[model samples]
Target: MPTITLSVKDENFAGKVLQEVLIGFHSETVTIRDIIEARVLQEVEAYNQKQPQYFNGLVQPADAEKTVNGYQLRNKVVIDPEKQVYVALDAFQKNGFFVLVDTLQCSSLNDKVRLHADTRISFIKLTPLVGG
Candidate 1:
């Protein structure tokens, strides 16, 4: 089983780690969409088992006025993991976030990339300006 590390980044490169999951790939490559899906599912499972303090993914901060660190929801909101993943994916399609595979930027969701034993995948969330 190979493992991939997820890291979240803002404007700065000093990113915070989101999670790590062991994924089984049929071949030496996998699609960007599949990678995102796996990452989201892992996050959802973690949230369901033991609710984390924060969620750093492709989401609009405006959805809830109150939040922790402007990413994690402040209120104890019940989230449908599948729905959240879909929302994130949709957002990605619209340039909501960016995916970097081992320091290389991935522009297309269907793009195939080779995997490594410890691949470092980073997600950079783009925040919209207020009243812009």
Candidate 2:
């Protein structure tokens, strides 16, 4: 299948998109696991190229501080895509965040998602309420 570019965003519970990027997928159909992996890889590659102090991806890195834009690593180091993918997958499984393919909510890591040229995917991180 021809590669398709889709819009990916990190959103908040208030429906505000904090960050956005366009990613190209080689296939139109992919599992949630695949999506996380690809997205992580792209984010890592971009960060690696720039060697930025903040990592703006699906999940935070080890010993990193969570900032408004992204995670601020303790040191300026190259992020491993595999580690990020692993953490992201675990986060999804543990309800740390949720994924939405267009308007459809994903239920499983193995769940299949259909992509279109205009499809938009959102990753919303779940923040715990301060007060009980």
Q: What is the C-alpha lDDT of each candidate?
A: 0.61, 0.80
Q: What is candidate 2's lDDT per residue for 14-131, written digit by digit as tens?
A: 9899899878789989999888888888888899899786777776777678877678877888777777777788878888889999878897999998888888799888952110
Q: Candidate 2: where is the Cα deviation over 4 Å?
A: 127-132
Best by the TM-score measure: 2
Off by over 4 Å in 1: 1-27, 56-66, 69-77, 128-132
- Cα RMSD (angstroms) for every candidate in the order listed: 5.0, 4.4
Model 1 poorest ten-residue lDDT run = 57-66
Over the stretch 18-110, how does candidate 1's per-residue lDDT look in tens digits?
433444555568888887777666555655576556654344323434254434555646556677667767777887778887888898989
Provide TM-scores for the models.
0.67, 0.89
**Residue 128 of model 1: what lDDT?**
34
Error of 1 at 18 (Å): 7.8
